[model samples]
Target: MVNQNNSAQSVEKTPSVDDKNLMNIAQYLKGVQQSHKRSIPPLDQWHPKHCGKMDLTVKANGEWWHEGQLIKRQALLDLFSSVLWKEEGKFYLKTPVEQIEIEVEDEPLLVSQVDQVDIDGKLYLQLTTTNQDVVVVDDQHPIFMRDYAGERRPYVHVRFGINALIQRHVFYHLVELGELDETEQGKAILVLKSGDLLLQLDS
Candidate 1:
């Protein structure tokens, strides 16, 4: 009887908020990694039971928040990002058995790193997301800008129907590497990729 009582107490003991968050994230990463090894799980097709909303939120400035506290751990953030997806104009982390919604003030991703390389006598831009996933700025994937509050905000396609908002410093680097040119149709563009990709600039 005493052993049963002790076991019950152990099970009943609640973990701290931070501990709970970590456990959930760790479990999610484990499942996601296994599924990713084969291929991206068909999160869109899986009609999983809707889990309750998580307290996770991504701010406009690319900061992540959990339970109203800033999530400063990059590793945790990266793990959470691996399962991100968008549908019906909303972002979600769709695990195998549950789909949880997270708040996103802006785009769900941030391109925090940038690099330029010479490919066949032309420079190619490589952009890295917060999750360390890299995408080349090429013909199929091009950089774009939008006017936000009278300022041009830079963005680029991340992957699988998602886009990343370029960080301020990364955008500055792109500006330095970008060259102005004209297309055959006389549209002004910024030539950032080699051979083909000429990003159209809004006049």
Candidate 2:
């Protein structure tokens, strides 16, 4: 759960760039976090009124920044990440009463680690995100290649329509676990297996 920041004071305003309004929004989000029971809030079910855009930006390297300063609190990052919502190709920090858009330079999240887990003698690849989201690699959380930053990169599906970029070291680890297979067209493809699913790691 995210503790309230010193920036968020109890003052309400119609959504704008005002620092007071931003504070109110953050305060409301903190309240929502305190009241929620699940590890991840049910952002799918939330239909908050559009509260305009915030200056918050998720950088390409997975750092969160608001205004011009870096958001350095891990708890706050976790809190905001819990309520992250993507719709129609846009991303927002959503709560029960309001939704504020945030800029995403690349993918909204990052896969910081990957582990191979054995379940009943079957091996599965599990990915852990920067926000501590653990997701098993399978059809539900498939890994696919996409063009990003002028290069082909592997991205995995996180929850709620959010996808995470596999970090360079993590991708190196994945390459060590994958096998190269040739398609019917005779092109080599690197793939990782999790249970019965085969995930492509290259384009």
Candidate 3:
């Protein structure tokens, strides 16, 4: 139930974006992360009137940097990853009281590994992110391809509005597991099937 500042005009009253402001926001988010260890913060419920853009950036390889300096603390990266909010194609670190925009060179997360699981005669694909987040590929968390550097690369929805780019080697392994299938238009495609769910790797 966190809320923004007192007035909608609070944007004019908020502190300017600076190194000190970044540090303050990071510390505040750290405390919030600790309180929500068993679950992600209620970011969708929190509303901030003005979200200012900042120099924080997540590199394509999933390295987080603040002002051109790498964030070496895995704990901070994990903490910030939890509050990542997306709006209108931009990224931000959000909290109940504040929202700070950040740059993302690619997807906010990276898929480091994947596994196939079978239960009750049903098959599923499980993905693990660099931050240790695990999600099963299903209707809600499906894989889709996007044009990256002139090539189509696969990405999977991780959580909230965040997505993880599948590492190249891992993506190759997924292609190996796929079988040839035909589209409704009778065009051949590569696909991976798990139980009743089917994903086209090549479109």
Candidate 4:
């Protein structure tokens, strides 16, 4: 579940298009957690029929919601993430028998830490997600920027077509590690790396 921080707050909640459908998925999540024993199940192998649309959402700030209420359980989010899959440019969670679609406001994952290395004249970068999964930032998992409401934010590919937003402190660290590289078009790009792991900075 992703609960580094969890507290119940009765603030006004965001409306969901399918709250009833989403709540059922939340209850079903408990079964998945119990049966899988806290590890990720083979969601890719499971091609179950679509149960329905889940009104579950991963907010822009990384908070998760179900049925218009804060989940308040990071563990629950982590559990759902274990079976999370993306197909046809959409996101879904799969249990052994059920598959449910979820809404994601932005990227579902977040970069929580950054590490760098240099070897043999090459640089590489490693990023840690909020889920504690570590992924190397390379050509395969490239880092770039996205525009959200006219503000630019840094993002990196984690895995399975999911991008993790680089947290503020880690972004600052990456900035300090950044250097200028000439592009093929002769334009300069600000980037950081550890070996072949290249992270591009965009304005």
Candidate 5:
């Protein structure tokens, strides 16, 4: 009887591990989806703001300006590295180390390559690419730079640079993979064809 009870307990514990693993997999997939969405910026509309010009050689000494209002360069770089934009051409940052690279085709795309394992101890497919671009603009405007006696403190503005073409590409890929169900609105949820969902969870 004791042996039988021990066996039952072991079986129960097995599923608990599996459940925990599934939850973890779900969270990882969710994170990847969110990151992909964030890398692209909206470029469908444009608004203009007024900016002041100043001489770089002269410092705005005795000028009463707000402190801690300036955006740090590292912050801007971090923003740009995560988000996609287009200035001269298509640009984006690859994850892990956030290496910036540009897509050269007529239609640019951002590729995210990830390695995932399955619950069955087998490897599976989770590799995919998304279309995106990086928008680069000169921060010559004094409003972007504090203490604007103009020291060539060029600021790089980062934002989404998505268009109809890229949007269609995303839509089509999801549809082609049969991952698109009418269940969600404004977003695509992919059903991965490879890799055990449970293994991915543990990973």
Candidate 6:
């Protein structure tokens, strides 16, 4: 996992009423409103054939079909997860942060971020403030989910702050998954059949 050097002390600062007021104003300006544009057709309304089958195979040396085209290894990773592992390794689905113990200076840090699981099981990324206040990043926010179309699918989104900690949790699972592969170049990719596309950790 990469080390994030931001001071843990920053988590101890308290926000003033002025700060709270500004945050409220921001939310008021940005909260979701009824759009004048045409509404998206319901997922159930779509024909079964239009909704692609959920495929979970690891394609290290094989090809995976995407949008009616056969995409090979590197291209598949780029298209799906937007991440390229330096070495061929398995990646696993991460466990929720609430299940782990996170501490700073021997004191347990309050969980300021909440875990969000979409219907499909993909995790959403989130951050928190020092006051133990939760800040749910808008799914439409550029830094949160990228592909809105992908997000519409069945998937889960879990939120957590502290990038390094999140990476640690993810990589820990990756390593565990790596142990299950028979080939050295074989890799595992978490596929969200339906969910948000943005890689928040990259942001």
C-alpha root-mean-square deviation, each candidate: 5.3, 5.5, 6.8, 8.0, 25.7, 22.3
Ranking by lDDT: 2, 3, 4, 1, 5, 6
lDDT string for model 1 (1-203, tens) is 13454565668664454445446656867655753332345666777666656778899888888777898887767777777888787788776666777788888889988898777887778898877778888766778887765777888887657789999898777767777778788876665654466665543
**Candidate 1: where are CA atoms >4 Å away?**
1-22, 31-47, 118-122, 180-189
- Write model 6 residue lDDT over 1-203, tens digit each, in one string: 11135345345655443333323333432332245322212222222221111223323222333333453544223222211111112221111110111112111112223344454465543433222223333454222112222331111222222211222243334234223323344543332211354332211
Candidate 2: lDDT of 89?
A: 93
Q: What is the TM-score of each candidate against the true structure?
A: 0.75, 0.83, 0.80, 0.73, 0.18, 0.18
lDDT of 1 at 149: 57
The 10-residue segment of model 1 with minimum total lDDT is: 34-43
Evaluate all candidate structures by whole-model CA lDDT and list the values in order: 0.73, 0.81, 0.79, 0.73, 0.30, 0.27
- Candidate 2 local accuracy as lDDT? 0.81
**lDDT per residue (tens digit) for residues 85-180 in model 3:** 888888988877788888999989988898999967888888888777788898989988888778778899977778999998988778777887
Q: In model 4, what is the error at residue 196, expressed in angstroms?
A: 2.1
Candidate 5 wrongly placed segments (more than 4 Å): 1-167, 179-190, 198-203
* Cand. 1 Cα-lDDT: 0.73
lDDT for residue 93 in candidate 2, whole number 0-100: 83
> How many pairs of residues in model 6 come into backbone collision?
20
Of candidates 5 and 4, the better by TM-score: 4
Q: Poorest 10 consecutive residues of model 3 by lDDT? A: 1-10
Error of 6 at 180 (Å): 11
